[model samples]
Target chain A: MTETTGTNTRVICPKCRQELPWFALNTDTMSLCTQCGSAIRACVFPALLHTHQPDPDLPVPVAEGDASCFHHAGRKAVAACEECGRFLCALCRINRMGRNVCAACLSRQKHDGALPNLTTERILYQQIAWTLTLLPLLVFPFLAITAPIAFGYAIHAIRQPPGILPQRRWPMILAALLALAEFALGLWIIHLMLDDMA
Target chain B: MTAESPSYQPFGRSTLESSLAYRIRHRLFTGPDHLLLVRQEGYRETYRRLYFRDIQAVIVRRTVWNRIYAAWLGTFTLAILLLAAVLAVKQSPPPAALIVFLIAWIPGLGLLINAHRGPTCDTWIQSAVQSLPLKPLNRLPLANRFIAAVRQPVESAQGTLNPAALQAFATDSAAPSGRGPETSSTPATDTATIPVLPFRPYRGHAHTVLFALLLVDLAHSLFRFHSTAPVMLITGLILSIALLTSLILALSRQAGTRLPNTIQGLTWTTLVYLVLAYSFHSSLMMFRLPTWNHSSPASLLQVLYPPAGTSMITTSFLVLSALMAGLTGSMGLVQLYRRQSGHPPPPPSPP
Candidate 1:
């Protein structure tokens, strides 16, 4: 992802290396290369690419009177971790989730999946409700148990926001209805048998 | 620094042109010392300028629209093939239908392959207090060069040597000057703090396998492999279990994350219901049970109840499976629609 910056800052077609016109560069849109006919996006001009400088990250040499990093005794302390109050050298000071954290705190947060910025996994309750409501219908009898559960889940899901993609509530509604109907039908059959026995 | 100097280069442009889509055009201008961003709408224009020293971070994030577009295109093409196959079986089989089906696959494969190539990225320049999103660029090399150009002046202005310069200096001096004396004992980079997660594609391995199994099932059903019903049933049962496990895993992993659970449930339910419905239907067919025909029924009772000589258990299973199949199918379609529209999933609650 990192590349060396040359003195020339012209936006060039990656395929052809020909300098792109001002119109192509400023429009921030994809255009066909004049020579190669390959589609190219002009937003990637040479001037914008950069590798983070190593100086800011380099650990300062510790002197007799200077405060040292908590973890590195030979390095000067640059910043304090916002969460743990640990002294950190330039290399140890991590900017994560808009906070300056030490390596330990960042590691702990990531391990716990507590960092809001990093989402590793998610649980979708609506899918469970939908599955419960509809999947057991094949067995017929299982619907008697699952229908009420599905209906209750649908109501619960309505109050909660959906996952990474929004989903309509109609499927849950349909599942609830179908489950209810199956339950009612089962009860009706039981009542008929009881009446005949009496 | 003056207007007449070659350093004052025009890097971006703003436009007042508005199509039916009402897209707002913005312009960027770059100089040796400063970068200016301008937004023009109709007769009014607003501008902001950032000095080289004040710029903090330049980030380029890849968008998922290309993958979505490719998936949609592939799905559409597959659907056309499915329609052709269904028509060929339901009516007089035509050689032209097979040709159309085979030809439709070429575009479908191309779209999927294109999607696998990844997306063009959107670039943003961030200062301490504000972030400005540059126009999206698809060319990786050009984008990298653009970042490097912006970085060079900013690093120079801040009195910090660029990475290339530092690397060159280190190579020439034959000594590690940046890292302190205790660098040998400590790791060069904090791997734990890197925040790299395992890559999980939208359609995972289980999904691909399930799709393949369904296709095979469909082909078998179309070709009338009645003797292979048991084999189909066993395969379907395995698929059902696999699907159930994947669904549970997916749900548990996302439990605390803010996501619309309904679609996940709908997709799982649809797949499970399809598997269950097909299994039950096949079982009934294997047993030679009389299928209930609503159109030929004499009354409502006949429609609701099994006809004479038909097993009540088999009839109930058939009816329930059909009902579930219809419900789950519609639900899955709704979920697909919501996803395609780019509705934001619910945000995760703080732990």
Candidate 2:
């Protein structure tokens, strides 16, 4: 039940909040918690002793002949929103994606999915291509419809960014090849059926 | 690397995690000043950046999920094999049933792959404002490599916490710290801090009950294995319901408990074993149902426990289940006893 008391930050065990001994932290080896005895490792930096500071430069009252904020008329303007060209106070300004945007424009951009920073999920075309190419094998009848689509998608994905991380081109390449083979097999089966009917 | 450098090097291998709703692949990339975590789900990629200076600590805790996952895959693989065995025993197994035997290798290979990946762990980065889990660092080896890769840059940015300074700070609470940026606008200087609370020992009542129930289940399984009296059927049904209830209760109650690690681990293992045993028994029952006569008065008993009519494979599986239950139950009891006696088991030795 021991806890360290300080305003200054100290590295504590994530499981048990007991302050880890100096030797236990930032070591090449794992250490046990003094209280709970869980095998835990902590890599502490100088940041462990540092506290977060609130942002300064909040909006100030407008002075005589000072530029007033577009939204907050009584406050002095700090910067203009890049998207809307409106003068914004420091409080209204949102700095993201290296652009000084107003809150309204930022909200609109997030809603439209135009801000990549706000996006939490993505649909990977390469994975979709792989799924389409492979999963259809279980239901062989659907190969006729999926193979061409999979081939086209994989080809399209080759020219585009696969994802944020580097991806191997092999799956897409192999999917295209497999799709072609599957299509050929489908066509061959259809021709055999026609020959039998004749 | 300079701050202006645009190129980002890949920091770790991309790891994929799946849930019922979504599957996400996570990758780590190192920028000059920050580490980027990219989560790719379907057609989109989400990025999170943790700056070097902002990172306070990277904590990695060992977990038993890797073994549990291996066991889960093994269970499915075993189920497939058991089905194949039943088919082989039948004089006329359907031709399509042969596919079950062949496809069992998929989960078998999955089990092998999971085992090859080594142990699993949970790694989290604690900043002042938030704690974020790094899903890409779920394995110990990967987590170590990632920690090694990011250590130098972060240390370079913030400098290291030497032992003397840490000891000095540990002794005196009111001493003025000479580290980090000191500014008049710093909020920590003006804000009131919360007092630390004493830790409470979690009384794992549900876990205690669960462990005891597993022992009872083991005893019941043994007794049922030997003699299939009609009373054993009722006892078996009651034990199943009680175990189910206790498992649900134990899972819900075990969260945030300061129990010993071994006990915590045993709890999870018991859960997995329960799932495996239940699934195996259910499949066995389904396989046996086809041979039962609808009009027979002893049909229920025959399907449930068939004293003299059980196959060698079924008998072997039941014995294995009893042995596993007994092992987990006894281990849990020993750990719980040690914990209660104020002599908890020592933490696992580091590798």
Candidate 3:
């Protein structure tokens, strides 16, 4: 009838470094290591802990291409960016003539870094986000220059995630597309207001 | 970013579970919908563990329930098809199409309702097995299996759950009728583990249906309006919104996100009102005049890069398109919810 009866436990949490004065009883608990609270499991009531083995043997190196991406280590990068040879994650890696380009240098190529095909998709998303932003030129002061400049930059960032980017050059494409959308939207509004008055 | 990298498609779906076919087994060809793949894996791992050796057990377990549930769902689908066919045959006017739609809608509603209840009957049996505290086999893979099994009912429920009536169910859905995780024993109190409603995969068929509906609306709007100036704006807005809502919900869910379910309700109401408001007034009046053209409700689609003077029909059609797009998104998400709600084939015994 003892509460900690099933305890053969001298186990401490890998997290807080505190001894868990808890019972395992008949149940095996896959719990965070008690001391550290990192995820772990106590297989049996009397289970013992072993020294850490951090050197998990990853897939054997083929050495055919530069070492696989650190994050997705199994996958081949095939080619690295000429500027920065840093390992790019799949999203970070861009394929041009079959070479991987990292993000930062890619952004430098075009003002905003949109590639050709990406511009259309990004603009579609931009239209939505801009609508949500509701940046009316008349409502805000000093917005005429500020807005175009901002949108020009936003055109670059349409598909940009927060990380190392790949080398890409489609800024011209996104800038032109965004400008067209904005110009069209502006003209339509003017025509609507004038017609309503008449 | 520059396009310097080879687009890495998935070589194939890899999973730790040995017994069950990768539910996301299609990812090899489907590319990396990694988020969806991972969730399916977690569910699959649990599924294979419980019934890995015993296909017979899984069959027996699900046969009665699956047959009944599938029948219900299949019937509703057939009824809807039938009504559509009937309307085409009748080919007369408003009342016949409405009658057919209403008549078929009931069975379609009942289909998922019947499918949704499958997991409820299996609950206590699973709980008993999982309750056997202090065992090695009971650990693992076993516990994970239990979680997957518990999730199956919610999947089933989505198939039967009246989606339109989801608003009504939202209040009671928290402590719902179907079985879910053993909340009492669970260490982590997260909503993802709650198993209230399982997420389903997106089906292209759902989008096709919505596309058809939008086309119908567009035809009506264009023919009714004299001018054709606002077409592009209408087209862009229509396509985007029709698919956006469901896409948002499914993407967030697939990413294993935790948005306030309450917010979903608010969005639902916002959606309903948007549709209501559009129908209530001369929603197309903005395009009535050349001068009145783009600034009006029709011009709302100027957001889609409208021409200087688009037609009223085109503009109204664009709004309609956006609404349908939004519906497509919503339906796609609902489909995900339904798929997640199916009976997780039980996991295999520990190898």
Best by DockQ: 2
After best superposition, candidate 1 residue B277: deviation in angstroms? 15
| lDDT values, one for every candidate | 0.52, 0.73, 0.37
Q: Rank the candidates by lDDT, best first.
A: 2, 1, 3
The order by descending TM-score is 2, 1, 3
lDDT, candidate 2, residue A108?
Answer: 80
In the range A108-147, model 2's lDDT, one tens digit per residue, is: 8665545544444555677678788888888776677888
**Residue lDDT tens for model 3, A54-159:** 4443334435645676446766544466667866545456665455676665665533534422221122333333442345545543333344654655554554
Q: What is the DockQ (computed on Cα atoms) for candidate 2? A: 0.29
TM-score of 2: 0.67
**Residue A177, candidate 3: alpha-carbon lDDT:** 58
Residues B7-42 of candidate 1: C-alpha lDDT, one tens digit per residue: 344553343446886655566667657776555543
Question: Which of candidates 1 and 3 reaches a greater DockQ?
Answer: 3
| Candidate number achieving the greatest TM-score relative to the actual structure | 2
Candidate 2's error at B283, in angstroms?
3.6
Better of 1 and 2 by lDDT: 2
1 or 3, which is superior by lDDT?
1
lDDT tens digits, residue span A105-158, model 1? 877765554552233234445666777766776766455566777777766666
Residue A178, model 2, lDDT: 89
- Ordered by DockQ, highest first, the candidates read 2, 3, 1
- Model 3 CA lDDT for position A123: 26
